[model samples]
Structure formats: structure tokens, C-alpha cells
Target: MSLFDKFEPLNAQYVRLEAIDANPFAITFDHVLSPTEAMIGDSRILLLGTNNYLGLTYDTEIVTKAVQATRAFGTGTTGSRIANGSYDGHKKLERALKDFYGRKHAMVFSTGYQANLGIISTLAGKNDHLLLDADSHASIYDGSRLGHAQVTRFRHNDPNDLHKRLRRLADVPGDKIVVVEGIYSMLGDTAPLREFAEVKREWGAYLIVDEAHSLGVLGETGRGLAEMQNVEPDVDFVVGTFSKSLGSVGGFCVSNLDDFDILRVACRPYMFTASLPPGVIAATMEALHQLRARPELRLRLIENARRLYAGLTGLGFCLGPEPSPVVSAIMPNPETAFALWSDLLKAGLYTNVSLPPATPNGLALLRSSVSAAHTPQQIDHAIALFEQTGRALGMVPASAATHASHHAAASPSLSVTSA
Candidate 1:
């Protein structure tokens, strides 16, 4: 057989998507205008699929810091941190993260995926057990497989199921590490962290929470769900990314464990990969400072999310369980979801088309995330476009359109003073 024959099934699926003009996987942005808008080819489209929750991608301060760092440290590290990639800026960023999370130690990785891979694989080794949420991110699953531990998955957000699984392992002589996310990326639903923490405590298992989507979008101080749910003490490790709220590229793990520093040498992913560029580290630090100094950004983000959620629900689109920065609409099927996504793109709106394996429970999703930089008019315009597209696609009725328009008209002002 040919070397590429194994990808025949994937090729067939790609052709099917292209035939329907719904091949979102091949789409690309030519230029980014702002945090909430971008140019795809020659058309300017409103960006709704980005995870830039606080919308600091184009912030003046962040850009300035990045530029300064580039001039100071040259371009790339050109080597792994274990060799020559560890610089003053990298060490400084780790220290800042350690202070930010109030943890005893912090280790930064080149990418968010590596942070998960390095931490999870190193923590649960040969004789250990890893209990993961069924809806956990792909990185978590890959990390579990990289290690020699036996992995068990509990139902998504089901604390009772987690308890039962941990109980079954009561007789097993090994360390148990329970992994969960602060906010699920697909459905925008948050995990019952308080309950999960309780269960982990009762079962004597260490808890690791991935706050990739919740950081800068939850908690009074923007710590994460653990802080929002008041269970920080129950959590043993916190894994997060600078790519999301921080508007940069990197990942980190913070823990109060006394020997957490050992991971610097033990984690293969971290030791083998080159570190982040100096510019990225600088920009991420600045963004973190901005996130802490400006709490109103989080408020504005939630307000925008609530507005969009209300508008879409009023137009009869099935949405996630609640209003969050990450909002997704479930479609009847993959074809319908693809058609809707293509329609939205044609209407100058850009969103994510998530299909099975990537989405939860085989559900197709038209995912749109709200950014703090999204203006009120931009959000309202997006709602109007969704209504028009939904009606044209028979996803929403004409009667629902009237109600949606009325709801949008009667909506309160979205003005919130920045700090």
C-alpha cells in the first residue's frame, strides 16, 4: 500500500466538505484589523471565533512591550530551555506567574499543549492512575496516553461518577490524579469544580484544573474557577495558557507542592522543546498585568456575552447552558451546521464550525466567542445577521424574527466604564 493510503477516509471527508462549500478547515485570515474583526481574502469579516476573551491582542501597551523585548533579546531562543533557551525574561515570567497564582513554584512551557503533556505525563507515571473527565481536552488525553498509567474517564461534569471511579481504585496502591477543566471549550459550560474538589479530597486524589477558558473571565481577581468557586485550597495544580486571556503564546503550571520544581528536569516535553520567544514572554507579562489592573474588562466581556446569548435565544437558536464568553449554538446536524457556518461567512461574519470528535457527544456546533473589544453595535449587528441567516436557512421562523428584533430594541445599554 502507498504511504498516504491511510488518509483515504479523511481525504473523502474533505472532498465532501469542499463540495458543499463548507470546508472551514481550509479557511484562512489574510489580515487582522482588530480584536473583533479580520480580513479573510478580500472581505472584511467580524471575528467571533477567537478565544481573545479580554481582547488584548491589539492593546497598545502589550505591543509596545513586545517590541521592546524583541529589540533587547533578539529574535528566537534557537534552543530548548534545558540547553540555552532559558533567558532572563523567561525566568521573570515564571516568577510573575508564581506570584500571580500564589503558588510555591511555577514552570512555563513553550505552548499550552506542552504544559499539559509535560505535567500530566510526568505526574502520573508507571503505577499511577489518572481519572479524567470524559469531555476533557485532547491534550489531556494525549498526556494520559504518553504515560504508562491506567486512565479512567468519568462522565462530563459528573462528580458522583468521579467518586464511584475513585472508590473502585481505593484498593489500588498508586497516586491518583484527577483532571478537569474550569470551563469547557465547546459547550461553554463550567465544571462543578466545588463538587469535584470535594470528591478528590474525599478520595485522597490530587486535583488538576485546566483554566484555559476561565482565566480572565472568572473570579473577582481573575484567578480562575477555583477562585470563583472558592475551592483554591482543594486544587493541587493549576494549568493555564497565555494564548487565551493573556493574548500571547505560552503555557504554565503552578502548584504549592514542595517539590514542584523537579518537573523542570523530569518533564520530557518541556525539556525537549525550545522555549517561547522573548517578545511573546514580554507581551504575556504585560497582558497579565493589564488583566489584573482592569477588572472592568471582564465585566464588559460578560455583558457582551449575555447580550449575544439573549439575542440568539430570543431568535430561537439553541445555545449553551448559560451566557459565557464562549457561546456555541447547536445545529440539527453536520450538514445544517456547515451550511449555517458558510452562510454566516458569506454575510461578513466569521465563526467556528466544530464537528464530531472535536465537539461534545457528536454534536455539531457553530461556535462564537465574545471579546471585550467587541462594540455594542458590532454585537447587535452580528445578532441581526444571525437572525437573517437562520430564517433563510429555516433554522428560525419569521415569527421568531419579530420577537428577536423587539428583544434587541428593548435591550438595555451596554456601557460599562473601564477601570
Candidate 2:
């Protein structure tokens, strides 16, 4: 049998996925929304699958700056930053981030994945060891692998497990990097940052917190989980992506270590990859300014999350621990999750379908991400649709193993929908 034939099976299998639609699933002028909201494909559909936590995607000021910078600097950087791609704007943004996060130094990367790749792989050589949460993002795991380091996965969100791994690694030498997410992408759960910080201190290990989804969503100033828990000082390094809350596409690494600047010279990924485009850097800088200046945005985001959580629960949908922007309605398998996602789309709603490998143990998830820009009406409508489609799938039927619990909106909490 041909190797290419193996790839064809994937196509044949998923092609008949239920409720699959052909049209692009983005929004247009038909929807009453800010410029950023216009980016969604399903215009009339309720937006419950976006990571625009603070919903700063369409601030006119940020857009205008992006336009002006693009006009002046052109579209592409045309060269790697290590070569001739570094512009005054790039340096300015880097300095601005250092000041914003109150860190000694910060380096900007083309994308968030690259940030982890460049940082982790550079810090952890072949001789070092990497201790990571089982629930870490794929980027973190891949970067650890690329480093050629000895990788060990600890239990998800379990500090005790991390402690055990650290104790074992204490016998090893060179560097030990402990990696965890600020807010897990699949389960939407947060790490016990303070507890992990203590373990890192006792074990003499370096800590790296990836704040991809948490930045601009957590903390009063929206710095992320470390900032929210007042454990910023304890974390040796902080990595974040601009794609989610910042309403832009970029990544950054901040550290107190001076040698990190040398990563520009030493890191192969950083040296090889082209720098972020001028327009993006411009928009990103503007987004950072807004993130720091507008704490009210974070408040509005939290309120929206609370309201969405309550509504989802009232409609008998399970949610994540605490009121996170990313809430999931988990199903037993991939087929079930895909069907629910399709139904939600048909019901004028949009969300993500998360399945195995991405989510552990083959658990399929109809993940909903609440945005600050989402109105109460939108959330309520989404809840009703979720309840309606979920029931049709026997999700709430008495015979289903996961149908034991009932969700009520009267409580001030998020109920996770799971099997």
C-alpha cells in the first residue's frame, strides 16, 4: 500500500462528518460589531469560540496605528531579525514590553510558538532536564523535545507530582526547566502558580510560565496568572503570545537574566525566522498600550465570563473550574464532539472542536471561548442552542453516563460539561 494512501483515509473518514457545512465560517458586515468582530466568519452566529478575552481587536486607535506603520514601513520585514530586519519599531516595542512587565529584559519573537521554541530549546540543552505538566500546550512539549533534553511529564495541575519529579531531577545537573501554562488551553484550568513557585524555590529549578491565553485576561493589570497571584517575582522567566488577548499575532520572552540577549546570536530558530511584519508590530505595540492602560477591559471580560458561565450552567452545560473565558462542553469521543460543533454552527453559533491528542485520553470537547465584546443576549442565545443540540445528541438523556448532574444558573460559578 502507498504511504500517500494512508493520508487519503483521513480525508475519506472526516469528509462525511455530520452537519459539516461548506461555506466559510467567518463574520461579515451583516453582524453589528466592532472592526475586530468583523473578523469572525459566521456573522449572524453567536461568537462563543473566540479568545479575544479583552476584545481589544477593534480599538480604532490600535488599527490606525497599524495602518500608519504599515504605510510607512511596508508589509514584510524581508529579513531575519538577526540579519537586517531589526527596525527602530522593533527595539521600541521590546523596550516598552520590558517596562510594562517590570522585567530587566524582554525579547520579541515572530510568533508565540517560536517564543517557547527559542526560549526553551535555548535554555535546555541536551544535558539538561525538562519537567512539564501533562496538560501543557503542544508547543511547550515540542520545544522541550527540540531541545533534546530529558523530558518528563508531571500530573496535570498537581504540585505534588511536580515536586516528586523535581526531587528526582535534583540528582541530575546542568539546568532543570519546569514548564506549565498560565491557563491550560484544553481544560481551561489554571496551575497552582504559588504552590509551584514554592516547589521551584526548594528544588532550585528554573520556572517558565507560558501566558499565551492568560495575558490580557488575568490579573488586575492583565499581566497573567503569575501577576494575578503575586508570584511574578518568583517565576524565573515569563513567555506570552500576543495572538489571544492582545488582539495581535506575536510572542515575547521576559527574563532577569542578561545572557538571554545572547539567545539572538545562539538560538537557531530566532536567527533563522523572519521578524514580525511592521504592521503587526505596530498593532501589537498599540495593543500592549491598551492592555496596560485599560484595566476596565479586564473587568468587563470577567463579567462577561461570569454571565456566560451562569447561562451555560442554566442550560445544563458543564464548564471549567472558576469562571474562565474558555469553557468546554466535553463529549465522549471525536465523532460526538464534531457533531455538536456542527449543530452549534447550524444553530447560528460558532465554537471550536477539540479532540484527542490535543485533549488527553481521547476526550472530545465542544469548546466555547467567551469574549469581552459578547453581549448578554448573545450568551443567552448560545446557552439555549447548546441545551437544545446537546439534548438531541442524548447528552442530557437519563441513559447517558454523564447525564447525572444538573446545572443551574442561580449559582455564581461555571459548571464543566463532561462525560
Candidate 3:
């Protein structure tokens, strides 16, 4: 009888999670010291759940650029891009992104979610087809709903399934757009981009690669999975966000399509939403330059990821497919996952706890992401903490805990705590 009645099920679930000290939907960091450290509720916690892959958030040069831009252009762009929000800095940033991706056209949106929504909804129209990975992000799914396309979902990372679906639409008269991500956010697993590209070509479908998690962490030049897989030429569009590696807020879609500029008026999300602030645009441009100049950051990030992954696996924890910027430890169930997550937080480590329905195949996850700014010592400290907490919670065996303790004791600077 009330408007709030629809949320009864979700409210019950939230209360249950809260009772167990596992509710992670709302958390706040009182102080962010750097990309890898933050203070939360009187505890100085190691930040492992942030997507700051390249760790440029605290870079002095980038900060200076942002400050200068804010002083010059004021705080915000109050109007949508279609109206008074179009500024010279926004245009300049678009030009920079265009050159960075080697694309003929680039359009900027207020946020990464908007970029996916705008691009997907505009590209696939009535009677058209929108094929997406089953494990795609929520933005991709919502974008499909906003459009009039008949959506199809294929198995995640299974190129054969994608090909089969495309083959089924052979007789269809409308255009087809296949959407995938460079790196899946939940599992941190990469797509078979080469195979996907091949299937798109065979089916004559447009391909869109969302590289939000892969940018600045893949390829020699950091163009993401498409560049690493050598399939850049096959991809019709590349969507990415500045909030991740760039340490700023914004989104963009770049393409070489001749009529790409027409989306300025056709894409509802882009045209209706206000553009990114001038300060963010300026800072993102600087961050891009920094990412390009320092290829070593990517190397450091992967090395940290591998070290952390190996440490967790050695301690008898299940992990993702491979070492990546994001490392997730799977738990036996939601309860166990929540317990471990709470234990980790109490041990001065902040990680992301992903529950069922949000995770793949209903598996819960304690997700941790590595950043280039994380020192070797910090990574080892985090490993020792995980070992202590995991062992206390019965997630790790006694023998493995003893082994980890012995290893920790051998290093004078490393100490394992029971907290």
C-alpha cells in the first residue's frame, strides 16, 4: 500500500548484512593520504579496493594543473554540453583524447557510466541488435535497455558463443553492435579480444570495447587490451574513463567512424548531461601525458599484482584466472566472505566485498586492486595481514599460517598482528 513496499526484500537483506558487520554498500574514508593509504574511522587502513591503477592521484604536477584550471574556469559547468557547458578546455581535452587513441573523433561525457550509456543507446537503434557479454558491467546492460535494440547475451569471454549468436542474426536486416570490456571489473579477467574481433568481422557487426579497467595497465603504450591483443584496427569504438588510471572524473568514446561527430545531437545521455568540469579535463590531460611518459608504472602495477596474487594463493586462497591489477579472493559463501571482509578491515586493510547477484555466478568476492604507488613493503605488509586474518577465520590452514608467520618473522620490518 506504500511506495516503499517494493524495497522490503532488499531492506531485509541489508539488515541481515548489517547484523553481521558485513554491509559494505556505504563506507567513507575520513582521510585519503595517497593512492594506497587512507584513514577510515580512526584506523589508518591500506587502500586496496580503489581503481587507481597508475596511482597518479597525488601527483604534484597533475594537482597543479587542476588547481590552475579551477582558478581560470571557475568550479563547475552548470549547463549541459549542448547548451552553455561547451568550453575551450573541454574541446582541447577531446582533441587530446582523439590523438591519444589515434581516432578521428572523440566525445567526452560527464562520467564513464554516461559514456557507455550514450554510446551504446545511440549506436544500436530500433530493429538493430546489441550483443553483450553476460558478465558486462551494469552500465552496458542499462544502455541496451535505453535503446530499442533487441539485446542478446553470450557467455563471458567465450568467443564461440558470440559467433554462434551473431550467426543466428545473419538474416536480420538491421545493424549489429557487439559490446565487450577489456578487463572485466568483478573477476579482473580479460576478454579474448582477438577472437571477438574476428567474430565481429565475420558477422559484419560494429565492436565496442570498454577499456575502463585496462587503460594504463595494459600494452607497452598503455592503450589497453585492444593494443595488447593487436586488434585495435578491428575495434570500431573504444570507451574509457578518467576516474580510474587518470585519477580524475570523466568518460570518453573514441572512434574513427566518419560520422562519429553526429552523436553530438543524437546521443541523449551526452546531449542532456552536463560536461566534465574544466579542472577535471585539465588534470586528466596531464595524467594522460604522465601515463604515456612513464611506462614503468604499468610494469610496477603488474609486478605488485603478481606478488600479491602469489602470496594469497600460496596461503591457500582461490583466485581469479591470472595476475592482474585487480586480485579477488573467492570465499566459500556469502557469510564466510563477509566475515573475512570484516576481519580484513579490522586488521587495518580496506577491501571491497562483492556479494551475490552482483558477483559472477553468485560467487562472493573480497576484491583488492593493486596500484603502482604501492611499495613492495606495503604489498608484503598487506600479504601478512591477509595471512593473519585469513588464518584466524579458518580461510587459511594452520600449516600455511605457520609457514607465512615464519616468512614474516624472517623479514625484520614485517610483523603479523592478531587484530
Candidate closest to the true structure, highest TM-score: 1
Cα-based lDDT for every prediction: 0.89, 0.78, 0.87
lDDT of 3 by residue, 1-419 (tens): 99999999999988998787667787788999999999987899999889999999999999999999999998888888887758998899999888888989999998999999999999999989999999999999999999999999999999999999999999988999999998889888888899999899998999999999988888758889888888999999999999999999989999999999999999999988778888898899999999989988887887788778778877888888867888899988877877888888889988898877778899889999999999988888888888899988877887774323323222211111110
TM-score of each: 0.96, 0.89, 0.95
* Model 3: residue 310 alpha-carbon error in angstroms: 0.8
Index of the highest-lDDT prediction:
1
* Distance from true location, Cα of 59 in model 3, Å: 0.7
Off by over 4 Å in 3: 401-419
lDDT of 1: 0.89
Better of 2 and 3 by lDDT: 3
Model 3: weakest 10-residue lDDT segment is 410-419
How would the candidate models be sorted by lDDT, starting from the highest?
1, 3, 2
User: Mind giving the per-residue lDDT tens digits that candidate 1 earns over 1-419?
Assistant: 99989999989989999898778999889999999999988899999999999999999999999999999998889989887748999889989988888888999998899899889999998999999999999999999999989999999999999999999999999999999998899988888888999899998999999999988988878888888888998999999999999999989999999988988889999999889999999999999999989998998898888878888888889988877887899999988989999999999999998888988889999999999999878888898899899999999988775433534432222212211
**Angstrom error at residue 191, model 2:** 0.3
